[model samples]
Target: MPPAYVEALGSVAAVLTTFCWIPQAVKVIRTRETRAISLTTQVALSVGVVLWLLYGILHVSWPLIGANAVTLVLLIVILAMKLRHG
Candidate 1:
């Protein structure tokens, strides 16, 4: 595959995964209810995202790095809300 095509694929993947948390994050922000959220899930996801970010950095892939960075922040917010409202 061409390099540009590969990069485009990665960017699409990054965009999807990064924005997947938005709905739940918005709900939490509005409702402030996170009792149903799982700490294990959140922690696992955060760790996974961090790992992806690190991998992106190592690979020098800006799309992956940027997507994961934003996702990490959003994940942190959800985790905090879960802790507060659990």
Candidate 2:
């Protein structure tokens, strides 16, 4: 495949995954509640995101870096809120 197409696909995947977190973040923020969320799941997700960020850096993947950076922020916020409220 062409570089343009590869980049486009990567960008699209990044956008979709990044946007997917918005709803969860907004819901947690608005409700200020996280009782329904599992602690194990959040921890695992945080670890996964961190690894993805590192992988992105190593690979020099802009899409991975951008997407994982935003996702990491969102996850951190949600985790904080969960700890505070739960």
Candidate 3:
């Protein structure tokens, strides 16, 4: 496959994972059932997201920047919910 296709695979993966979190975030918000969610996991995810956002911005990867931004917000919401009710 061409390098372009390989790079596109990365974007596709980003989109799928980033968007997939939407449903989980929505479910968590609605049910407020976050006992199964780990505090450590959310914290680590948030940190990773922020770092990815920074890397995306520095590298001018708009797709990464946008996806990470949305993912970061979702993670923050989940983290806050977990902290509030965990």
Q: Global lDDT of each model?
A: 0.91, 0.90, 0.92
Model number with the top lDDT: 3
The digit string of per-residue lDDT tens for model 3 on 1-86 reads 99999989988998898988888889889999999998999999999999999999999989889999999999988898899889
Q: Look at candidate 1 and tell me the lDDT of residue 57.
A: 100
| Weakest ten-residue segment in model 2 by summed lDDT | 10-19
- Candidate 2, 1-86: lDDT as tens digits: 99999988977887988778888889999999899999889889999999999999999988789889999999998888888888
List candidate 3 segments past 4 Å from native: none
Candidate 2 C-alpha RMSD relative to the actual structure? 2.0
Ranking by TM-score: 3, 2, 1
Q: Please list the Cα RMSD from the true structure of every candidate, rounded to 1 decimal place.
A: 2.2, 2.0, 1.4
For residues 14-65, write the lDDT of model 1, one tens digit per residue. Answer: 7888888899889999999888888999999999999999999999988879
- Which segments of model 1 are wrong by more than 4 Å? 1-10
Q: Pick the candidate with the highest TM-score.
A: 3
Q: What is the alpha-carbon lDDT for the whole of candidate 1?
A: 0.91
How does model 3 fare in lDDT?
0.92
Residue 25 error, candidate 2, Å: 1.2
